[model samples]
Target: MTRGYTGEVSPGTPADVRELGTLTISKLSVGPMDNNAYLLRCRATGEQVLIDAANEAPRLLELAGDAGLAAVVTTHRHMDHWVALEEVVATTGARSLVHADDADGLPIPSESLVEGDRVRVGDCELEVIHIVGHTPGSIALVHRDDAGGTHLFTGDSLFPGGVGNTDQDPVRFASLINDVEQKIFDRLPDETWFYPGHGGDSTLGAERPALPDWRARGW
Candidate 1:
């Protein structure tokens, strides 16, 4: 069974929960933008890693559960994505990881992360995949399960229907699309489940076939 959610969130409660084998993923949708903050836990050891401490500190702390957070990773340096970074990190005492290029934009100190780096939750490993588009240092994390499928935590750089906005420019859009197609689509298997920074989840199989359409629209 899934864990870490109270399931009765009003304005400030844990969003939702899902179980994927050894992992328990909890979400908190906060802030005026409705940004999503994710808490991923390794069930065996009760170790956790929080992705984008977007907002609602009290709610986030509640969602963090008893596993104790191992780290907090910023998907990018967008303002909307980190309102409670200081409070959350201060409360949990969890290390913060941000891409080298984007670390400067963060209000708090963080370790520099590079491509291919591994972020651990207990023994579970998540590989860093940098897809530079929405921001100079936008990134996604990939976790492979024992069943051979993968879970991709795509921040604003990717979503269900289309790529995230890139200043609404064709050039920027193309760059993001190229990076995503080459880095994520080409290398990973189609069975991957994409957990975006906002909204609902989608599978690679559900999205791959629409690449051409997305490219044509130039979003």
Candidate 2:
């Protein structure tokens, strides 16, 4: 069966799995907040990594199964994003990782991550990019597939419509959008697919035309 990557996932629905030549990305929605959690498994080595325990540890752990997680990455310090962090880490013994700025907010201690860090999943690796404003230490992970396709895991930093909320603060909003533009939009090709924390996924190309509108609106 050929599965599509529509990026539409509901809390109780099954995960949407996107299988690349060297990696498998399974995305699931969990908790009342509708946080999206991603499980990345390497095809060659069978090693896995879970991004954002989010909520519903039982469901996330069930999805992980016996292979277990090598690490759990928290995108930011938001409570909703890490509601199930402690439990999932306890059960899987996965190393906990979060950006340095948000590290203090997590329930458990984590290895501090920064830009240019590579997170290994068996034979595959994901590069980390630091995005500011949404949170002091918000970070996004970038993965390049075997076929040269780029996949981005943006926590609450970059969404489909615009950047994450900065409470309408102009300074923070500018900081976020600028960083996103320079680091993400300018550097990555339009075909790059981005997976966000809350809602559906979108290609950078789909949103490129809206940057001006988003900046003007001061969101």
Candidate 2: worst-modelled 10 consecutive residues by lDDT: 1-10
Q: Please give the CA lDDT of all the candidate structures.
A: 0.84, 0.94
Stretches of candidate 1 above 4 Å error? 1-14
Alpha carbon deviation, residue 198, candidate 2 (Å): 0.8
Candidate 1 lDDT by residue in tens digits, 6-51 = 3333345446887877787776788677788888888778899999
Please report the candidate that would top lDDT against the real structure.
2
| Residue pairs of candidate 2 with colliding backbone atoms | none
Position 196, candidate 2: lDDT? 98
lDDT of 1 at 105: 87
Per-residue accuracy of model 2 over 154-194 as CA lDDT, tens digit each: 99999999999999888899999999999999999999999
Q: What is the lDDT of residue 74 in candidate 1?
A: 95
- lDDT against true structure, model 1: 0.84
Off by over 4 Å in 2: none
